[model samples]
Target: MPLHLPHLRSVINSDGAAIFDAEQGTLTTLNATGAMLWRGIEQGHSKEQLLQSLADATQLPEEQLRLDIEEFLEQLTAQHLITSE
Candidate 1:
């Protein structure tokens, strides 16, 4: 599945990233890990690629990274920050 962010603006800094939803007027902050995942999605990475990258960066198992990424994607979808394409 492809992920899409609609009417949202994201800013990445040294610490992490900030996301603003213009349509809903909501603001969200992401830690380094979250920012990495968000940027991966924004760049049109496949799920497998994302999992591999995250696992490499965190030194975690692929299964664990998969679960975490799934949960994060769910939250973004729930908050209307992202949609499936």
Candidate 2:
């Protein structure tokens, strides 16, 4: 699935990322891991690519990484930060 980001402004830093939803007037904060994932999303990475990237960055199992990414994507969807197409 491709992710669609709408009306979101973000600042990614070394420590984490801060995302602002101008349409919703809400702010969301993310940790370092989330910052990496957000960068991938902005770069138009596929789910598989994201999993591979995480696998490359961490010593975790691919299955676990998949689940984690799914959960994170779901949370982003729930918060109206992203939509899957």
Candidate 1 whole-model C-alpha lDDT, 0 to 1: 0.85
Can you tell me which runs of candidate 1 are displaced by over 4 Å? Answer: none
Q: After superposition, how far is residue 48 of candidate 1 from its true place, in Å?
A: 1.1
How well is each residue in 1-85 modelled by candidate 1, as lDDT tens digits? 5475768899986688899999989999999888888888889898888898898888988888889889988998998888887
Alpha-carbon runs more than 4 Å astray in model 2: none
In order, what lDDT does every prediction score? 0.85, 0.89
Instruction: Give the range of the ten consecutive residues with the poorest summed lDDT in model 1.
Output: 1-10
Error of 1 at 23 (Å): 0.3
TM-score of each: 0.92, 0.94
Relative to the true structure, candidate 1 reaches a TM of: 0.92
